[model samples]
Target chain A: MTQTALAETRTAEQGMAAHARAWLDANLPDALREDRPSTRRNTVAELCDWEAKLHRAGLVGATWPKEYGGGGLGLRAHLDISREIGRTPMPESVNSIGKELAGPIIMAVGRPEQKAEYLPAILEMRDIWCQGFSEPNAGSDLAGLRTRAVQTADGWVVNGQKIWTSGASKSRRCLLLARTGPVEDRHRGLVLFALRTDTPGVDIREIQSIDGERSFCEVFLNNVVIPEEDMLGSPDEGWAAATRVLSIERATNRMHRAWRFENQLNHLVSACLSDPATRHLAESTYRRALAEVSVNIELLKGHVETLVGSLIDGQEIGPRGSLPKLFWSEAHQGFARLALEIVSQFPVEASDTLRVARKRMEDIYLKSRAETIYAGTTEIQLDIISKRILQLKRKA
Target chain B: MTTDTELNPEDFVETARAVTTACAEAAGLPERMDLLAEAGLTGILAPEAVGGMDLPLGFAVPVLRAAGGGFLAAPLLECMLLARAFAGVDDALASAIVSGEMPVTVAWSGMLGGTSGVVGRAPLAEACARVLVLGADEGGVLVTPGEGAMVETESTLDLERPEARVRVTAASGPELSADAVARLRADALVLRAALILGAAEDCLSRAADYAQERVQFGRPLSANQSIQHHLARDCLAVETIRNNIHRSLSPECAVPAAAARATFVGAATLGARVAESAIQVHGGMGFTWEVPLHRHLRMIKALAAQGGAADLIEAVAADLLANAA
Candidate 1:
């Protein structure tokens, strides 16, 4: 392309980003803003409605195909939208599993009919999806999952228990992974199903998490009959599909996180500054720590932007995604701890903003503990970096 | 010297690595400067009129990276900045510095007031023919140390290139505007970030190689989970620094000064941590002078101090607080 074309492309992207920023500023209500003291506890229906509105505004699913109720503006525009969403202290997507993980994998390996059916519904927020990859014994060793799915004359019958299935209680669909072969076949003979959660034998029980949210659930599939059309791909394609989902989960899933991290930091500082007793926490007492947090936020942004650029250039992220995964988890956890410490010091007569910040930070601190534990544990990320990225040989 | 339009910075990396490696064996400062000038590195950021390529500061990053990795004792970063600063203001001195005739270093701390003042943190000031100091008016002044000026070597963490305190009783040279000084300071932060990143990469490479070769407890040290985790963390830190540096240099950076300062501070702090981990990976041999891991660690510490990481952090914090809404 000529230099003029390149300049034009940049101008267009900047215009799109500016439009997104302005749209979000005008649309997002203060009652839904996480950073605002007036924010109320939004219900699942309210959050889902807001997300669907975001989709309508082209702020969500910007990269999904236009045939699937998406804007189809491409990854750069998606990133621009995500950045705008992140800059504001808005709530996380209630159906992120559907949009980020399940939707992308379905696009990759789903049948055309499946994509036509599931993709649009996901974007429309009509079908909330929950991932069913982790089992009682297969959290990190996902391939060792023992969920049995035997094909009967009618359909496929699945009997298994999945743990840590976030949003399962509210989800309408499950991206369930089950094995068709014996236990010895670790990665082979596995099958993925877009199982309906309201199926007769399927049971979902909420598990209260440390953050006092019952988002995490234990999904029990007892002779749950799944239709043949619901199979994601071929029987042996499950491992590949699962790995693809995991990699996306590690890399580009929720690309707004780094920006959100910065928003959280700014919220903490702003809250501290709202009160005389707490102002010194950000001004002088914990200045170095706050500065370190600011620096770490930049590093996290660097990682995310670099990955996005690489993806746009058609380069495979592969295990290189673990870098940001490890860095952000550890760094954000540190920031959460620091934020809690600062907010915990607020006086009894602190400002309402400080009280709201304290509550938000307390939840963040509790939820951050699971950040490293989930999305492949810190140890798993380290192992991937050492073995896959560094290619270090294992002990003989 | 080549014109800026005719040169590509990526094309100079191999030559820079080779020349800087050769400089380690050079007899003295002049030979080192000669080697660097021969490779066209000294004039990379200077003007074509002053016999320089007049390329962007990005062109000098690879050269300084090589210098830092090879531990070349000459004041290359200082010379490049000084030569660029003197380009139009004093073409003769810029030409001299670029042609390896006059070796120069910059006093990163203290300002020269009236006729004399003490300036410190000038690396290899005793070996250089000229030193650049900030003036009281926030401009830049080139000082040719002579009878009235005294150079005092300050014991520092970096033994090979200890910073010097120059007491300038009489100084006179071409003056640079305040804008030039500010630009030079920002440029210095970026270049130092690149240098520290290079040193950290070298340390990581050496540590990984040693871990693979060294056998302990009936297996290679790399097999140990603890050792592998350490090296992996170092790799993450190194990549973070590299990415941050690139981001700071990219045109998309919103605030170039703040980005550059963040890059320098991140590189210094994380680069030192990486070096420390590299030493731990090497066991006892890493602590000895023969191993040379300590040199990179020392250089990183000195760079952090010289760049005023603590003060930068405070400034960053102050900005964050003041912007609170």
Candidate 2:
């Protein structure tokens, strides 16, 4: 309550805001501010081009090691850029797995040679990547995968199927988890490989989701040859390396999803220009949802900031990833559903634009249904909360 | 602007628990009206100069959380919210609040201007000597005995906090200006958020206890990993929502107006889930009137729909995606 304390708080607020503004001004391009929300507005090629431009502009890879093509800034600034990215709707960044999933794992456990090759391309978005972890029978129980990678002289010969592969069609390689041991070695035998998606033995077939975007694919790998050096971390240590994907420096994809959802909300509210009563209702509803989401963004930001602050001090977040991931995805799904409902109420002013957006919202809502189910179900999050934070024993 | 890690620290919670325990002992439980007056909790935001504890809304959240540890629900807590709003740095309202002399309540059932013409006046306008209403044309009213009266309706859930339909027959006292009312509404909402936070913490505790004690088939309910998991998950929801409420109150997170509706929805949604699950954990006993599970569950439902909780949730969710662009 003292004037000094109040003043100190305000000053800190301004400092943070200023940091966010600088990043936005420098990196958030004006070109992607389209009127309608498009799940498919940004393409893989376009995103790569923009990221390469960002790297050239010295704006990409904040927390990446100085050895890699990273800015070498700490995680606070890394997260700050993520918040800055939310302020604008530049096309979706394509190398998400590069920055979030692959890069972090590679950095944590990769050999020096592996980092020299893979990390820079990820920043440049030169190599599109997809995660081939979930198989037909394995989802929440991801350790029970059926993807088989057999040992060969050259490296490993992989022959298996990975369904629900995001961007498999456009991906150059995959951070794949395949079974090397028997079913009982569920958690132990799983190994990760950065395998070429275009190898002769690999086939990518699109699985068109409720969302019209064919981002999800059913990938088939038959005797696909993977180089020995491409594997991230030691053999049988995929899960441990995978933990890096949830940390602040590595979870930029979640940050991006949070940002994209925030942007779509603003467009929906403004575009509904007719019927004062309806428009006003739509706007009010959108505002409330935004407020809730703003809190979510801030919550995620807090989690990120904590992760970063702790990392700077050499502390680890461990299993708390469930909280942020579950919170954001559940909230994201709710927002997507709201966007669909609100858009449906509006009459078609311009059939082409409005109709497309309405249809898109519908698609996105349905497609996003899998997000909660994928990665991990909300139930799995509860499991983590109990066993980890609450320190509860496994059930009797 | 304020993040959770910075805002929700261990010390703040300690203060909340301390004040709540003092108030609980000072007054009675289950419905502690006297605690409001005993601890000057009735005037949490009233100026320190006027004998009120000069606490911000964020700090006050813990106090409310403490009171909720008991199953008590009463109008004294709500009165404190109005007092906080009306009592500025040196407002006379602060004096009245600290003394527990003045009483008032607000009506926001009609936020979209529908309440202005269609809805009748608040009964506190006459019955309780003061009334508060919010909207584009918003403000507090200093009512007299002749000004208004209420048609009462006791809620099935939180019976302690009685609601009613009011009719303003006369404006015997001064009318609060729109600006003054807006400031007060914001202040009051911050306080209301704290109160809800308290109630949510209560629901979580209740669920946790029931999980350990309630037995089914010769085993503790908590023995079920899934159920135990859910109870802890509820703890996280309440914690996150509480953290959000705290952020909304902080100077850095000065996203007050937004925080009000967002936290309300968050708490209500989570409270309902916890309440419902608590009942399920108790099995048949939870459904009986003797059990408090249904009471808290119904209370959350009532407050949730009454305010702009759902409406705000929908709007804010859209803006979240919107502002991203």
Candidate 3:
């Protein structure tokens, strides 16, 4: 290799390693407490405190433009930070909406004043946010959502309910996507607003899910009064923004989740260590699967980093982002299911490692179960691959 | 063998696809014998400067996938895998392999939970000069195929990658360096996975086609939601394996062989399930020897047992987890 090229590569690696180490050390939780899979709000809040630390340190939202009190680093920095944060079992950052989805979209579409009012608050955790998009009637058929927004001279009045709103009960703001077009224009006529969860007409009630975390809540927007400065993006632009938002979630987040699964896989390895034969056998199978998962994660990371690089250079990812999301989600599910199969015979809390291991598997299994269901289901991912990537004709 | 920086995966895949397609059209696994020698596939470790394709795992993987599909019934992969421990350093042997003149065999003896050195018959025993052996420690050795280098044909699941019983007295050839043995063990995985890729693809397409055309009740089996879902699930499984293979195909040995082991082992295990379902789709025809589905069933089982599938993938996972970044 040429000296100059070699120098450039070394500098990049050193910088990334330093950036990655800083984030990993600061964000990983100091401890892992639950023997059972836990996503309780308490766990989430503790995770948020780390984000608040990162916010204070100028590491969180470093990808955002510096005008909004962000670090304004590149995608490599963003990925390195995320990769590092995965080293620990900390709670998922509560400001996930702002740091991940809402911030990126708001930057693209929010009016200058709206940006000034909301962006800084979100980055600093002065206000927490939740997405009020999916409703009871709309899950996979998201465009069919019936939430309606009536235009007012001042702003818009929303009169509908959004269910499965993660963090709605605690959030200070909602990136509420409501229908503004005719009933038939399923996707086209939508508008987004940054309405306060504490607004007079807003009501939130937590629901019990299979995991029993109470992480998601139902939000009833009864004539929720929103202001003119609160609209996120242009009117009728919500669908596009939401789609971009989902695609971004698919690309950026799944890599770290895959990395986190490696820890669970490690615990599984320690399970069979006492028995040389089983250790040989168990470690053999699990190690190989872990290696395979690691390789795929690297591939996915490389892919997303490439896309983000192109985007930084003014390129769009098109529909291929679905490939990694679908692949990793299923891959994770397989990894989790494989863990259960390997260690099911162990008492629910056999080895401390096994007990710790079981919780990891269940958490990932639960999360992975959503992979094929959300960020587009497996079927949806396939459709995207077929129609968008391969451009295969739809069979009659 | 050398890593070809100039070759992209797409290009390697294209070459492999063409090669395998031609083989598939002709003799499936039955044709593997002549094809390996004809294509010089049994000599991948020979330097490209000496006439080999000289590719890393990425190039090797696609070729294996193609060969697996082609059902080229030969000890081609076994030869190349063992040959990794024999090339360059053994000038005469490597030169013969580069010229498509050397044929070799990989005898596990004690690898993959085997004891007393159970082995398969090698085609090159009487012809070519060298034979590679996975030793008592699961390490590999390249020894001469002369004198007490015994070879006997054992009953094999897939006739394509021929298996035989081998018994060696006190025979010896030029010993391989430790590094060569590691490379051989790793490539053994890639070789095994490549074959599974072909087998899995064969099973998936056949199952999908059968579901569309076969009729059980009034509706075509394809119309059955259960069947559609199964087929769709199988398609996803197959894609995951393929994705695993793609990642495995880099010049960097970090993932290729490891992924090959995990993916091939996983594919082989799950692939057998698909093959069983494939048979069910054909009803009675699936069981009868006249139908071709049994071949895949046999091949899948056969590949799963080869190159130490379970142990390798588990080891790979453990190592990866140990070094988590």
Candidate 4:
């Protein structure tokens, strides 16, 4: 494109962003958009409706191919949409597993028939997917998962249990990992499946998290049948497919997370400004901590931009993907911890705003603890950097 | 943001790196400065009209990093900051330095003042044509010819860059505005931070090499999990400093001071850690002067004290508090 044409295209993108900002302002429900703890609840039906509206507005899947119900735009469009989404204090997207993870994986490696079958429902939030990868024995060593899937005449029978399954209780479908060969076969023996959560002999029991939420659960499978067509790729291609999904998970979701982090800091800063009492609670130490958090958040933002840039340029993040994952997770956890420290210092009979802030801070602190553990532990991340990116030799 | 007369940063950095590599084997400051001036790094930040690259301070960061990586003897970092300080305020001196006709070193006592007091130690003072004394105000800076100033050489840990105590008469030289002084200070910190980062990266790279080659118990030292984790964490700290530096240099960051301060403090502090770990990874050989790992360690120690983290933290706290209030 010519210089003027490029400028015009940028202007048009900015215009789309402005329109998105206005649309989100007009459409997002007050409760979902509000900062109060009471409004923080994610009611399933309402969130599903919101997701459908978002998909209709072309904001939910802007970077996905147009044939698969996305806006068929580039990364710039997604960034624009993210900037607007960051404005509202909305809860997590109710169907994030389907929308972010499963959808991307299906698009990248799934058969065309699988894409046609899964992508639209995911965009519409009609098929909520929860990951069933981490099992009782295979938290970090995911290849060790013993969720066995025996091939039957017309399908596969899955049996075994997955632990720490987020959104398992509310999900309609699952992106699962089950062993197709002997348990000792490790990664090569694993297969990825898209299984209906309501299938017979499948059990999802909610596990109360530290924050007293039942979002995470344990999924047990006993002869739960998955059709041959439901296999994500060829049998035994689960590790490759899951690696792609994890890379997408680390790259794409972070824009919103980074913005949310910014919003959280802004809210705290505003609160500290408005109430001398709140400011006095932690005083200089609090301000210093806030400063530290701000600098680190900007660092994370910069790191994310680099990662996303690599993605935009069609460069594989490869082992370098671990850098952003490690940086953002630690930055987020540190920010949440700072919030908790500030909030716990709030005086009794605090205003409703302080109370709400305290509650959210509590939730963030608890939720942040898992950030390092899930989606690859901090230890695992360091290992990847050391052995893969840094090319350090592993012990025999 | 680049004028047609401006140097392309990539080309500039490449040329700077070549000069750096060539100067790596040379022992003396004059010889190194000749190579550096040939590459135009001594005037990299000066406008092209004066035979300089006329590049922004951000562009000069890599050159500083490369210089720091090799422990080059040229006063490029000091020259770049001084050139930028004198850019609009004192074009004559800036132009002279930009033209590579003069080599200048800066003394950060507190700020520019004409008062007869000890200017903070000037690095490689004997090698420069002039020493610029910085005080609280821009106009407060006194530029004294390098030889005319009362100078006391001090033995320091960072032997690569010699340090000296200089006393100058109060208000003796051309003064700059406070705005100019602040910009100059920020630029100086950024260059120093990049240097620290470069030195730290070299430390890590050397340690990794040592770990890979040095065997223990029939395996490479890196084969040990403890060593792997140590290097990994140090690598993260280095990456953090790198990210902060890049962020600080970006156009959109409204307050570069925080990022600069963060990078400065982070680089020095973490650079020290990496240097220390690098020594440990080398076993007893690291303790010997022959290993050269101790040079990075000493530089990091010197840098850590250059601009105290306490002041940066105070500034951040005060800014955040003021914004909150």
Candidate 5:
């Protein structure tokens, strides 16, 4: 190898390792470090506080343009920061919809005014965002959504209901997709509005999912008025915007889940270490099952690493994203379910790790049940994969 | 045998693909073997100093995939894998392999003890000049000349490859270290995975083509969502295995154990499903021997048991649990 090339490689490795070390030391708080599975429930205030810390460290928005409050680093820096953050069991970003989905779309296709107005607030965690793509009837068949956005002399009036909108009650804004054209014009006539959750007609109803978390909510838009300027991209082209958003969402969100699963698996192992009953149970009937889950998680880590590299290189993942999504979701559901069974055998203890482990396991177990349902159901993903990627013909 | 030639992976894959495709339609095994050997594929993995390309072992993966795609019956992969074993360990044997003076094959799994009686027939043992009897229980793997061993050729489901059960009464030859034996086993698993992936790719493509061309109820079979989803699921399996292979080849991977685990999942398990789905797409035509789709199915069934998927899974699990502990 050439001396110059070898030196460059060494420099890159050293810089990445140094950043990882620094982030590990400063970013994790005592509460988070002690909470093995991170059972903080991650309230908006706490999440915002953590985001502020991340911002202070110049970790947030590493890939977004510098003028709009991003670090303006390359995508490699973004991925490196993400990998470092994954070493801990911190709660997911409170501004996930804003930072991951909404922010990337605005950067890619939003007008300069939209980027300037929203990107900084998103990076600073001042504006938390929730997605409003899936209506009650449009969960998998998203384009079949019936939400209407009629243009008025002043702005647009939106009236519809969005179901399974997680964090709606807490979020300040919604990255909403509403029908602007005729109802039958599926996918073509939709418009994405950066709708304010506090708009006069907006109402959020909390729904307690099986996981016992009221994070999922139903949002009712009763004649909410969104100014024409708030639309994300061109009117009647929200389908294209939605596609790009979903692609970015799938690419970044799933990699985090893969790493988070690794963290959960580690906690499960730690719980087994803390109690003899669980350890014995794990060794006896649950060894292979637990081990297989571990294998899958490892496989997922490798898969995600490759994916992250591709995303950084600006390579198109396209329908291939469905592969990781399917593998990780099924793997997590299986792992979490097995963990609940095994952890249930452990003696009740006041130890922090044990206490947090039980809670995290229960939450993950129930939550994983929905993993296959959300972000496009397994069936929908399979359809996309087969029909689009594999070039299979539609049934006549 | 002295040479210092560098080999590029893309070139090797293209060359092997061309040769394997030509040999795929050959009349008999000897002709296919001759064609592949003439293409310099038989010694592709031996060090260039030994009259071979001495390409990185990573290159062997895609070549094997191509061979599996064509179902070429030349025992090319076994020779490459065996060449990896013989490199530096025996210069004379490695040179013979590069020049096609001697063709070697190894058992799927075997042991070191001669008195322990029959070790099941290794893969392609009947067709090779020598068979490497891998020592699973013992620390050292032994090389036994094919002529000295009690060999009996047997009919198998996978007609493209032949096998034999041999009792190695003369068990003496070059012995490999325990580490070497483990490395060889891991290499074999990786190559096996490539073959499985190749076969899966071909099966899926063939199934997709058949679905597109064949009409049921006045529409292509692919028009059916069920068939599309079946092929889609197979695509996921194949892609995931490919991802795993790329991961295993990364320089950061210090050992091939993790790669073997991936191979076990991708090759041993998914390979069978893909072949089955391929046949399902073919319906009645797939049931007959004339279509050649059944060859993949038979190969999958045979290869799935070669490296013990269950054991590989256990190893992967154990390593992870140990790390957790």
Candidate 6:
């Protein structure tokens, strides 16, 4: 690119970020802002509506093709928008599974019809997706799953029990992973389906979690029939396609998380300063710990931005994605713990802000317990780093 | 004799590596300084008018990294920083330092009160004629040892080039502005982080190579899951520090001050941890003087102590609190 063209591109990117910041600042309701004392619990419908608005404003799916209800911007623009989104304390997307996972996979290996059908629906918040890769017998060892799909004259029959299926109760579709081969054929003959969750014999039961949310569900696929057209890719292509999408998603998904982590830290400090009894928490007493947390936050941002740069350079993330996943999960969990400890020390006569911070921090601390357990687990990430990135040998 | 515009910072990597390796094998400080000046590394960030490259600060990163990784026992970072600090203010001195005609080191800690005070953490001060220290007003002043100043070596973890405590009976030199002092300190933090990163990277490579080659119980140590995990964590830590350093240098950093301090503290803390892990992977061999793993650890700890990691951490916390909404 010429110097002038490069300068123009930079200006345009800056405009993209400025536009996102302005739009979000103007549109995001105070009631949904997590940093505000007036913030209240938002209904799922309200969150979905807010997300659809974000899409209409070109704040969501900025990099997805324009033909698929997206802004058709470059990945840099998408990253710029994500930073703005993260700087604000907005709620997480209610359909992250649909937009980040299902949408990307369909775009990659989906039939043209599948992309046309599912991609726009995800951007418009018309569908919520629940991943079905984990089963009662397989969590981190995803390939060890026994969820079997048998092809018959009518369609494929899927019979399995999936545990920890987050958002299963509200999902319109399931990104179902099942084996078409024998049970012993781990990671082979695995097929993926955009299975309709309301199909006959499909049951969803909510599981109450530590944070008092029933967002997690146990899904029973009792001979549920999935049409042949719903299969994401050709037979036996599921494992490869899913892994590819997962590797990218692990790196690029939730790009705003680092910014949001900063937002949380800022909120904790501001809340502590709002009350006389809690002011010391933000003062010299917890200074070193807070500084350490601040460093971790910067490191997390560094990991994220570095990954974004590599991706923009057309480099394959592969197992290197495990770095950010491992760092963010562990660091965010630590921050959550620290935030909880500070909030727990609030005096009996606390300010309204302190109470709200205590409540949010309590939820954050409880929910963080699952952060390391999810997304391939801390142990799984460590194993991948050592075995793949480091290529450490194993004993014969 | 390439001008700053003719070369990118990355172009210096191979040259820096080669020169640093040569310096490591050189007999004494003068030989090492000559090697650095001959390669134009000592003046990497100095002004072109002073017979220097006048390159950006990024140009010094690779040189420092090579120096640290190769265990080049010279005050190269301090010289580069001091040369830049002296440029324009004392062009002759800058030119001298850049040309390897005069050796100078900076005392990272302590300030001169009135005309005399004790300033410490001057690396290899005995070999240098002058030492730079913070003045009473928090600016920078250059003091010539034995010309109304004295140097006392304080032997520490790094035995090869122990740091010195300088006592100035009379201070006389060109004074750097407060802004220049702050900029120099911030730049020092970044350069120090890069140096520590290089040392840690070398240690990690050594450990990984040893693990793959050293066998135990009919299998190489790399084959063991525990060793693999240990090395993996060290790799992650090293990568994190690298990323943090890059972030500190990026133009998009929103809070450069906080970011620089964080990078330094992160590097100091995590760099030492990685060094310890590398030593562990080497087993008893690492504890021996011949392995050289202890040298890297010593450097990391000594650097961390030089700037006082706890103080940096608290300052970072104070900054965050001060900026709190």
List per-prediction Cα lDDT, in the order shown. Answer: 0.87, 0.62, 0.64, 0.76, 0.75, 0.87
lDDT of 5 at A77: 57
- Return whichever of 4 and 6 wins on TM-score: 6
Q: Give fnat of each prediction, in order.
A: 0.56, 0.31, 0.11, 0.47, 0.61, 0.63
Residue ranges of candidate 6 with Cα displaced over 4 Å: A1-12, A36-40, B1-6
Q: TM-scores across all candidates?
A: 0.96, 0.75, 0.79, 0.89, 0.90, 0.95
RMSD of 6: 2.3
Worst 10 residues of 4 chain A by lDDT: A33-42
What is the DockQ for all candidates, taken in turn? 0.67, 0.25, 0.15, 0.48, 0.54, 0.66
lDDT per residue, candidate 1, B48-87, as tens digits? 8988888888788878887788897888898898899898
Tens-place lDDT per residue, model 5, B176-281, is: 6767767766777777888888888999999999999998899898888788888888897787777777767766443456655765565677788888889988
Candidate with the greatest DockQ versus the true structure: 1
Candidate 4 per-residue lDDT, tens place, B1-325, comes to 2466544555556676788889988777667776777777877777665566667777888888887888776678777767756766678888777656677776755553446567665777767777777664454464565433566677767767766667765446666677776777777777887888888889899989888888778999899888888888888878767777776787645457666776776676667888898899888999999998888787767655555555776676666566645
Single out the weakest 10-residue window by summed lDDT for candidate 6 chain B: B1-10
Q: Write the per-residue lDDT of candidate 3 for residues A133-213, one digit (tens) a residue.
A: 788988777788888888888678889989888888879989998888665888788888888888899999998766657
Tens digits of per-residue lDDT for model 2, A31-129:
544544445466556667777876765556765766788765555555455665665656556667667787878777778888898888888777878
When sorted by DockQ, best at the front, the candidate numbers are 1, 6, 5, 4, 2, 3
Stretch of 10 with least lDDT, candidate 2 chain B: B117-126
Model 1 stretches with alpha carbons more than 4 Å out: A1-12, A38-40, B1-8
